[model samples]
Target: MKTIDCLGDMCPIPILKAQKALKLSPSGTTIKVVTDHSCTLESMLNHFKKYEITSTEVINGVWEIFITKS
Candidate 1:
């Protein structure tokens, strides 16, 4: 698993970072994204939906999105 910390990053930064991580990660790899922005999560959901990846909230207050690359 790869971990990405996007805390305090606004808007598209988190989403963009997630995208980069996904591209760099191998197939079937799991990437963990930590962010405080809700909009980032929404955008991530939309972006990963095509890959059928799901994001899980691991911690409260801060959002932890888990993406498994297919």
Candidate 2:
């Protein structure tokens, strides 16, 4: 499990970082992204959905996304 803390990041920073991390991660790895921005969360979710990755977002502002290499 890899944890990504984007708590204070704004806009595309969190989403960009998460995408980079996912590219470097192996299959079946889990990445926990902590962000305070709802827009970033939504963008992240959308990206994940596009890739068919499994993700869960908590209204409290935490997004736990799971990715598996195909």
Candidate 3:
């Protein structure tokens, strides 16, 4: 499990960082991303969907995304 804090970062940075984490993660890795911006969350969610990554969005504005090696 790894945590990525993108609280102050704007769009793309959070997602890009998450992508990098995923690339380096082993199978069944869980990456928790914290972002204050809803748009960034939405973009990240949409981007994850394209790769079929499993994710859960909490009410507190936290996005928990799970990446598994294919």
lDDT of 1: 0.82
Runs of candidate 2 with Cα error greater than 4 angstroms are 51-70
> What 10-residue stretch in candidate 3 is worst by lDDT?
61-70
Model 1, position 68, has a per-residue lDDT of 85
Clashes of each: 0, 0, 0
Q: What ranges in model 3 sit over 4 Å off?
A: 50-70
Q: What is the lDDT of every predicted structure here?
A: 0.82, 0.70, 0.74
Model 3: per-residue lDDT, tens digit, 1-70?
Answer: 6888887899889889988988998866677777778787678768886454566676677666554444
In lDDT terms, which candidate is top?
A: 1
Pick the winner on TM-score between candidates 2 and 3: 3
Q: Is candidate 2 or candidate 3 better by lDDT?
A: 3
How many clashes show up in model 3? 0
Please provide, for model 2 over 1-70, each residue's C-alpha lDDT reduced to its tens digit, 9 standing for 90 to 100.
6778887889788878878887998866667777777787678767776454555666666666554444
